[model samples]
Target: MFCFSCCMPQDNVNQEPSTKPYQDTKPLASIANLSLKTDSTRQRYVAEEIEKLGKNNISADIFTFHDLSVATNNFDADNLVGEGGFGRVYKGRINIQGKDEDVAVKQLDRNGFQGNREFLVEVMMLSLLHHQNLVNLVGYCSEGDQRILVYEYMINGSLEDHLLNTSPEKKGLTWDVRMKIAHGAARGLEYLHETASPPVIYRDFKSSNILLDANFNPKLSDFGLAKIGPVGERPHVSTRVMGTYGYCAPEYASTGQLTTKSDVYSFGVVFLEMITGRRVIDNARPSQEHNLIEWAQPLFKDKKKFHTMADPLLEGNYPEKSLYQALAIAAMCLQEDAASRPLISDVVTALEFLSPQPGDP
Candidate 1:
């Protein structure tokens, strides 16, 4: 078999550090005030962080705010990707030393509480882990206080970009694309929950956060809210509740006890999004239908009613067995008792099974 991806494996590529004619090394965003200590230890720590991130199939580069500003044309709206609780994500590119290739950059707000930690977590986790289903983080910049995380450009944007606003009349994502995206995103989350050292708990999972590439493959992003699960015998991490509404697991939301299952619950919500093409919470919807989780919870078991929850774009072409299997997996994930929810590994297994295989559906 031949591996055709343009990228080939390398043991560790030290991202070509700047040896340029310019000197203004600051983030292009607002995080321009961080007073980095000159100690070799601090530099080593940041360097190690970058190397660790690079090992997981992510390329790495450290750009100052000056470089990013030049790339984004000063945060022009045309370069914007999207916005959320953190800040607007701008699309830009930076050329690191030696590579002679430009890479996509994600610039976050300097002052946003969600910027720093999320920047580092995304840097640390995404760089160390590799999977076909997960997105790749190319590199990041934390010059001064201006933090910017970079990833390979994902075109077609996010699942949210297509599902909710996409026209049902035309230009809609096909049923096949949606299922593949769901399965891929689930696999990414599964890798985070089960494969990383010390095991990471992805507190957030939603359509808007799942980015898509040119082929419509989904990549999970935004790890600022991630929590490192206990390494020993502890079953969960007790933290202040953090996550977008509607997707938070019922038990984790109520009790603040988080485990991999908590993420399973969130993955279920994403699955529901794949099936229904609606935001987890939408006020414009009728009051009766505004509450997505509550409304969909019951129908998950009633196979006869499954079609009602499906996205209209699907035009009723989904496989009954696949849809039912997906629904059943989601039902277990959303179980009120956290213990009842399946592990992320199990969730991925179920999703993989439901997806189209080598043969016919």
Candidate 2:
């Protein structure tokens, strides 16, 4: 269910606003102007923008800084769940209507890679889009110098945790689970590409952004890089190239021409990661084998070498025929020509056939 709630800080009404010196190194004047000469003015501008979004029927909770502070136990390090270039995500519980729900609170670090623009894009995109395979945005907080987003907590965390950073005590995902995740993620991308009005290009698609629930159901999160697809008669949306290295489409990387097919190329890279259990770029490997796609190109051409691409962690547990079918789909998606890459819907169809049945081993 897509819903939002607003809460204001009740405890600090009478206290004087802090007079401490602002320490953020970046000049406030550069942040969308709106006369952000002071922290209070910037907060007001952000709040107004959010209010305008709400008026436009973009449903999202307006949370006060105090509400999130309490929800996250004052953003305690103990509650931290994940951290990246953008900022840290903390596990928090917030009251939704009458019920207390666990949520992931993503607070933007002023010094982080992303800032106001990315934050606004994510809120607007998530507010307007909803899908079973897409992460749910619960609410947001725009309060004095604080920019935070609230999302439904995914119990199992990101695919990266299970795939690349598994510890000695943690068992890797089962073959069935991996197939399920791949299929679910494909569906999410399909929704964005085929169903959404004007379409949406998921400019960033990688394992780290794919989150899994307790049931291992996959949902694509982090829409800050998303852009509406090109309109009729246009081949692609020409924009600045910005995406994780290794997963970006070759054509898009070179020409800055973004199409839904660019996302297909990225999906191919992630699917390859699932099959091989190797980083997209692993410097630890022999120099020649550093790039996974480069290393797999020859193997992909020969049917006999296909087995070598399967993750050893699978321990020969997956069905051989299923592996072949999956690799075939990945190869199609990874085609050098963006025009040659299969549509996300087609990828979903192929994955549907590869998904395990009820009684399958």
Candidate 3:
């Protein structure tokens, strides 16, 4: 029900707070006063926005700082599961709905680029959007400088871990599983783009953001950069460009204008990475092969060379015809012109056909 255009003032939407590094010279009392005031202001804004958007029944639980601290074992280093520019994620256990549940706790660094605004947006978006392929938000802790998020634990970790950076102990993802992951991840994007009330643009879409459970079921995570798309007759939403490098679409990188097609292009980059088992931008590779897209574009023009793009780790066990079809889908998504890219629904349909059949695991 939250339409960015109709529910909120344009000037108030997508405004990022200007932040600077914390200085030790500030007096303790002054800093404390400022923190309290900022916290109160943020809470007030969240209340007002939820009322405006008619999302007062937001289901995400609210947690206290002490609760998360206890769940994460007083923020021990050994429990750490993942790390990023924003903060570190820890594997934790907490009771939810009268049942003991494992969770991934993301404790945002107060000094990081992702501040209160990003936190609010992520909380709001994930609180409202629900899909099987989308990670569920367990709760959040927004006490003072603490901006932590709790999510369902992904036991299998990320697609990047199994696909791009496979270790000796971790088995490589099979062709069927890879295709299944593609289908699930594509479905998540399709839901965000076509089904969400206002149609969200997943500004950041990459392998690492796609998490997996024990069964290799993929779920999309990290909604901090998501934005509501232009509604009504608007062609696209204009905003400052923000997303992972190498995966960003050429048009969006150059022009801040964004649409559902931008996410399609990013998904293409990730799909190609899954097939080739290579990083989007790796300097260690030969100069010509440094950029994955640049190297794969020429090969896509000829069907005979499609086999060369398959991940060598696959050991040629995959179906050749399926490889060609998958590459063709990626090529269409990676098209230079945004207009030529397929909608996420089309991508989902294509991957669904390539998915594992009923019996075989």
Candidate 4:
């Protein structure tokens, strides 16, 4: 299928062949050229790295196996950034043919559960997605048992870091920043659902998967759980249910009927995380509140308790109207029935209407 994530077909750039020497431009339309290469260990590393980086930059700084190894000091743990189901992330810098550049490398565990298919899935989907609020995939490496994906580093790290209340100095994401993130991330999903060919379902859209650039802008990441919808006229696909426990759509979990609304449900769970500074699925909660979706339902319905849901770290400085609008959008997304959920397009429209402008942001 033609790539639909980046731009409308009407915007396709048709440049005449240049007689001059090569000049750097945006990446070539090469989606048709990509395919999965074999190598379990390397694929594992790539998956782990991309998630930790939050997004990869497909248009720049791709590295070869040799180039990546030297930059990462042979995958030293001292440079480690974070860990996840896929692998550990380490900071790396490669001076490709003497041009100094910084990058992050993921090292996958040999015994890890994630595999090559996920690595290829991310590379394929991310290669086609471009947006200011989404991380870019710079380059990737795969050879034998070593697999690595390089990405544009999000200096501030995941939104989860800033929102956690347990940290004494949690920079506490501001209401404006939180709303901007919500709006940007919603646009990213909207593009995926409405713009991309065969509409990709992110399947995983949680706080930790949202990374922050230096300016605190949020970018969606982690496409391992992403699904490119079936070809023409097929409404949905079936698969073994997989996703963070709290974020999966109830209808999807029950029926295995995957649709765009599945992602809408997941996005709603993340919306709650952004507002409340709570994990989508937390084992630490009291048994009665163990299920985050059920526990948080009432608070979203009542404006008084909306303050309760607001990150106390904010100290209740947010605009009530805007907060309610976001809550209203989230409530619609978290509907128990898939048919009741609003489209990502509608979510994008609501967020656009409610998003804070420059001075306010």
On lDDT, the candidate that comes out on top is 2
Q: Which candidate model has the greater lDDT, 2 or 3?
A: 2
Residue 234 lDDT (model 4) = 80
Candidate 2 lDDT, 62-172, residue by residue in tens: 899899999999999999999977788999999999999999999987643355656767887787777888898999987756789999999999999999887778898
Q: Write the per-residue lDDT of candidate 4 for residues 99-209, one digit (tens) a residue.
A: 776666765555533545455566666666666666776777655555566777788888777775346744677788888788778877877776666567888888788
- Descending-TM-score candidate ranking: 2, 3, 4, 1
Candidate 1 lDDT for residue 62: 60
Off by over 4 Å in 3: 1-55, 359-361
What lDDT score belongs to each candidate, Candidate 1 first? 0.68, 0.81, 0.80, 0.68
Q: Residues 1-361, candidate 1, lDDT per residue (tens digit)? A: 1111111123322212111121121111111211253333343444445554445444466667787888778889988767776667777766656554434567666664455546766665555556666666666776765677767778778888788767646477777787778877877776666656566788988888888888887888777677777658887888789898888987788889888888888888888877888788989999988988888877865768877877877788888766666667667767787777677666655555555544665
- Candidates ranked by lDDT: 2, 3, 4, 1
Angstrom error of the Cα, residue 79, model 3: value is 0.7
- Give the per-residue lDDT digits (tens) of candidate 3, residues 1-361: 1111221123321211122222222111121232344545655554344344334556778888898988989989999999997789999999898998999999877764345556666777776678888898888887766789899999999999899888867678889999999988998888888777578899999999999999999999999888878789999988889999999999899999999999999999999999999999999999999999999988887777888899988889898868877887888889888998888877776676678845655
Better of 2 and 4 by lDDT: 2
- lDDT over C-alpha atoms for residue 123 of model 2: 82
Per-prediction TM-score to the true structure, in the order listed: 0.80, 0.87, 0.86, 0.80
**Which 10 consecutive positions of candidate 1 have the poorest summed lDDT?**
20-29
